[model samples]
Target: MHQILLIRHGEAAKSPTDADPGLTPLGQRQAETLADDLDRQFPGGEGVRLVSSPKTRARQTAIPVAGRWQARVDEQHNVIEIPSPEGMPLAERGQWIRTLLKSRWDTLSPAQGNWREDITDYLLQLASTRDEGRFHTTLVFCHFMVINSVVAAIRNDLQVVQFYPDYASQTHLAIDDGKLHLVQLGQETNIGSLIQ
Candidate 1:
């Protein structure tokens, strides 16, 4: 079995108009704190493969840890944040997400539904890659919805919002027999107004 670490990116430094936001100062601090904690929790991070979403915030979050281990971050766009709807203004994206949270994933439009499928499939493929029939661990720094998509797939949950993972939260999972199992969910913070 391969153990996967799904790390949500730290808070972003962007307003409602930003289509792509980098990490905020506070967010950078959070990532630093996460680096220290990762040393304590996982120790050395020696053999773990590093993967990151192709987003500014996620790449920023992955950097310190990758640097500490002298590892490279494998950026793949499939792990990116949820795609906004056609012509949806960046300013309205949060509200759109909030609304989506209350809805069901299976009811989305073809394009959106395909996006969700693609993300989940991407993660599953990552989990199944092993060396010499041995399981390996992968650390993925990604967006909130990308994390949720995998969680939902594992739990058979159709609802969009399975849980709210805090900034820098790390969720653990194991893949065995072509199935994904949630070993542990990440820490959840009450950031009701910080949904973006």
Candidate 2:
């Protein structure tokens, strides 16, 4: 079986209007603490692969863990946050995301549906491939919705939002015999803002 850890990115310093924002000070500290926790779980980061979404916050969240493991992080566009509609103003993105959170996967726009499919396919491909003597566990630093997407898919649920994953929270999954299974849900938080 292949193990996958889906880690939500740390809190962003700026609002969602900024397009791409780095982490807050507290978020950076959270990342550090997460690194320590992961180190205890997988000492020296042996037999592990590090991956991060291309977004700034996700990339920033992976820094400490990458440093701890002395490993290079592979930036993956497929694991990025859910896309906003074309021509949607940055200021309006928060409201859009809030609405999206209440939506079902079957109701997604064509682009959004495509995005979900791409991410799911990418993860399945990753899990099915074996690297001989290399990594067995993949640490993916990604966004809130991305984690939810994978979890919802695995559970065969249509909901757009499965569970609320907090900053630096880790959701575990296992893949075996070409199937995905949920090992554990991540730590959840009840937050008002989906774009925070």
Candidate 3:
């Protein structure tokens, strides 16, 4: 059996100055807390592999956990977030995001190419890796839409895949006999637990 843990990146800053905006202060703390919880759950980190989307928030979230597990983090472009073009007013941006949820297009090509290809390809790669017995446990840090897309593909449940989870939330699944058995979805990570 291969276990896959899907994680949403921690909170991002309000205004994205950089090409890929990183996690905010609260987001960083959230990542740290999640990392601690992960360590508690998987003590030795044996048979574990870490993979992340290339965005700053996802990369940042994976780095600490990967380091703690003494594992190298691999970036898979196919796991990246859906692309929204730059330079839009706040209200328009908000509307744009909503349209994105409805699977509306920013451009015919970017929406069709990146989102569709990434989701399908990533799932196929993950399934192949699982079949090869490369790792018993795998952690994937990616955006909400991308993560849900892959999960939806695995379970053949398109409706549930569109629902986005909160920051730092997790979903767990076990693939046994080449089928996905969902253990949990939308497991919230409490940053307050860490502070306490």
- Which predicted model would earn the best lDDT? 2
lDDT of 1 at 102: 84
lDDT rank, highest first?
Answer: 2, 1, 3
Model 3: CA > 4 A from native: 85-94, 102-114, 127-134, 154-161, 177-181, 188-196
Candidate 3 Cα lDDT to native? 0.70
Q: Tell me how far candidate 2 lies from the true structure as C-alpha RMSD in angstroms.
A: 1.2
What is the per-residue lDDT of model 2 for residues 1-196, given as tens digits with 9 covering 90 to 100? 7889999998887675589989999889989999999999999999999999999999999999899889999999999999989899989998888888898999988998899889878877776555735878989999999999899999899998899999999999987888778999999977742465
User: What TM-score fits each model?
Assistant: 0.92, 0.96, 0.77
Best by TM-score: 2
lDDT of 3 at 84: 55
Q: How many backbone clashes does candidate 1 have?
A: 0
Worst 10 residues of 1 by lDDT: 126-135
- TM-score of decoy 1: 0.92
lDDT of 3 by residue, 1-196 (tens): 6778888888877452355778889889989998998899888577677889899999999877887888899898877876556556444554555555555233345554567566655544566653466577778888877766666666665442345577888888777766666788876444321110
**Models ranked on TM-score:** 2, 1, 3
| Candidate 1 structure quality by residue, lDDT tens digits, 1-196 | 7888999999887678777789999899999999888877667786688889888899999888888878788998888888889998888988888888788889778878888888767767875544524437888999778878888888898988788899999999987887788999999878562364
Give the Cα error of residue 94 in candidate 2, in Å. 0.2
Q: TM-score of the candidate numbered 2?
A: 0.96
Q: Runs in model 2 with CA error above 4 Å?
A: none
